[model samples]
Target: MFSGKLFLMFVATAMAQKDLSVDCGDDEWVTVRWRPELGFSQELDSSRALLGNCPPSRPASEDSLFFRVFLRDCGFIQQVTAGRVSYSNTLIYDPQPERAFISQPVQCVYDLSVGEEEPEETFSMEIMNPDFSGPAQSLRFRLGSSIPIRAVVEPRSRRPLRIYLESCEFATDANISRAAQVHPIIANAGCLMGSKAGNSSFLPRRRPDEMRLYLEAVWFAVGEQVFLHCVLEACAVQSLPVVRKACQFVPEHHRWVLLDDPSQSYACTCCDSSCLRTTDASVDGVSARKVLGPLVIVAEDPQGDASLDSQSSAGLSEAPVWLLVFAVVLVLMVCMSVLAVSYYLCFWRGGRLGYRPSRDLLTKY
Candidate 1:
C-alpha cells in the first residue's frame, strides 16, 4: 500500500509542474530577442541546445550564473519534442569580447520568429583623429603630442591586419616622382616618411593587432604640415589562410594636422578652441587646425595679435581710416565718370545732318 501511494504522489506532482506557460523567458527575467528566422528549428540540434535534450544537471558557465531557484513566474521552460507551431524562438547569448566564443548559457526560446536572418554585416576601419569642427576630417596636435593610434574591426574576423600612418603628401607631382617607392597598397606606403621634420619611422613599436598601440612621441617641429595617411592591410596567418581572401581594405587619407608649437605666435588658422583626447589631462598640448603647404609664420604686432602675412590677420585691425576714405572716393569717381558719359551720349546733338532746329518739325499753330 505504501509503495502504491508513493507512485500516485509522484504522478500528481508532475501534473502540477506541467504549467510551463508561467515559466517562459521574458524581458523582466532574462534579456530576450525574437529571432524569426530560427522558427520551427531547434537551435542546438537537440544536443548542444540550451533547452530540450539538456542534461539532468546544469553547469555554470562563469561564476555560477546558472539558476536553481524556482519562482512563480509566467511561461514554463518547455523542451521541444517536435512541431512547426513552436517556431519563432527567442535567442539570448552573452556578447563576448573580440575573438572569444559565447558562453554555454546562450538561451533560445520558442517565443519569436524572424523570416530573415540579421542584416548583412559591414566592415569598416577608422582612425580616431582629433575632431575640431568642419568637414576636413583632421587631427590637431601640439609639437610634442603622441596620439594613441587605434582601429576598430567589427564582426571580429580572426584575420590579422595592420594599420599604417605615414607622412604622405598626395600631390600628382609627388605621386609621379615617387612612383617606384609607392606601395600599390597605401596611397604611398613605400614613400612613408617619418615626420615632416624628419624623425623615426612611424611603425608600431611592437606587433600591433586590434588593441590600441601606445607609441612613443615622435616630436615634429611646430607649424609642420603632417598629412598622415592610413592603410588597412590583411596579413596572412598559417591558421586562417581563407581569412586573407575575405579581408580586403584600402588606404584612406584620414588625418591632416598642422602642429602648433606653443612658442609660435599666431593661433591656429583652423582650430577654434583647445583640443583634448580621452586621456589628455596628464599629457601636454592643446588642439589646433591643420594648415597645408609651408607654414606661414605671422609676427605678432605690439598693437595687436595677428598674422604677419596676407594669409594672416595682421593687417585687418591696423587698417588706417584714410584707406576706407580712399576706397569710398575711388568708388564715387567711377560712378561720376559713368554718369558723365551716359549724359553726353544720350543728350548730345551730333546727328547725321548736324543739329536740326526744333521749330523745323513743329506744326504751325
Candidate 2:
C-alpha cells in the first residue's frame, strides 16, 4: 500500500514537468522551445542548457524559452548507422544537481539521396601551376613542386554560394573505389593531414564560388599516376553559419588558421583533434564529389640532366676537330691543282715556240 502511494506521487511529478519541442526545420539552425508554467522562468538556468554551445535567443513570448542554435554549434554530435547520417544533442532545462530536468534528445537525420541533384558541369576540380592562371600543362612534376588545385562551383542562379572542401584523397585511380589504395591529404573535416610533413592546405578564398587547395608535390606517390578526389559542400552564402570554414596549419607558429576568416581562428582548433562531421540534405546546400587526375610525381634526376649537357658538350667539341681536318685537306687539294695547271701551261708554251721556229726556217730555205 505504501508503494502504491509513492508511484502515484511519481506520476504526478512527471506530469508536472514542462512541455518542450525540438525543431530541426532547416540546415543551419535548430530551434528549441520549452514551454513552462507562467512565472517559472526563475527556476530555469538558461546557460546550463547545451542546445548549442551558445546562449538562447530572447524570449519571443513570455511563457516559453526559445533557443536558436546553429547546427554545427553547441555540443551536437553526429552518428552514422547503416549508411544513414544523423546529428543529436541533449538539452538540459534545469541545472540543479539532483533535481535536473532534461529534454528528450533532439536528432536531425538526412537521407543521402535527398539533396538537390548536382549537374555534371556544376562542379569540377583541376590541377593548376603555382600561378593558378590555368590548368597545369603537363601532369609530370618534380618532387617538391607547388601544385595548386582548384575546385569550382558554377552558379546556377543569382543566389550567392560558397564552396568548402570537406575532405580530399590521393589515389591512383580517378574513381576511388573501396578496394583502391588512397592517401587522405585532407580529412576529419578539413584537417590537413599532409601538413605534418609538407605544406598542404586550403588557400584563403578569393571568391565564394571557388576554393583552391595548395599542395606541395611530394614523393609519396612518385612515378605513379595519382589522382585527387575531393568531397565539397556548396552552401548559400547568405545563410552561412560558423560551420563553413577552411583551415590550414601554420608551421611557423605551430598553429592553425581559418583561411576564409582568420578572426575565427578558434574554429580551427579542432584540427588538432577531431571535428564533428555532419551531412544534411537541405535546400540551402548540397554536397559534391569531384576528381582531378593523372598527376605524375617525377623524381628529380640531376644525373640525367647532367648527362644531356655532357653529350651536347662532346658533340660541340668534336664538331670543331672535324671542321679543322676538312679545312686542311681542302687547302692541300687546292695547292696541288694550281701547281698541275701551271706545269701544263708552261710545257705547252715551250712546245709551241720550238715548232714555230722550225717551220719558219724550212719556209725561208
Q: In terms of lDDT, which candidate is strongest?
A: 2
How high is the CA lDDT of each candidate model? 0.27, 0.63
Q: How many clashing residue pairs are found in candidate 1?
A: 22
lDDT of 2 by residue, 1-365 (tens): 00011111111112234576655543445677765432344555455443423346763365466876655444355444443445565544544656535554566664434343323226777888778999887777778877888888887777777887777777777644321346777765666777766877677678888888778787667788888777666777743346666778888878888777777788778877767655434435545566777777778852456677888988855566778999999999999999877776667656332334468777897
lDDT, candidate 2, equals 0.63
Lowest lDDT 10-residue stretch of candidate 2: 1-10
Please, what are the lDDT tens digits per residue for candidate 1 over residues 1-365? Answer: 00010111111111223211122232112221111122243242212212211121244332222332111111122222221111112122222224222222222333222342221212233334433122223344433344434533333445443322211222111212211111121112112233323322232224433323222223332333333223232232232211111111112322222221222212211122221112111221111111122211122221233234543654557787899999999999999999887766666754333456578557655
Backbone clashes under 3 angstroms, per model? 22, 2
**Candidate 1: residue 161 Cα off by (Å):** 4.5
Best by TM-score: 2
Give residue 208's error in model 1 in angstroms.
5.3
Error of 1 at 135 (Å): 16
Write down the TM-score of every candidate: 0.21, 0.51
Q: What is the lDDT of residue 345 in candidate 1?
A: 60
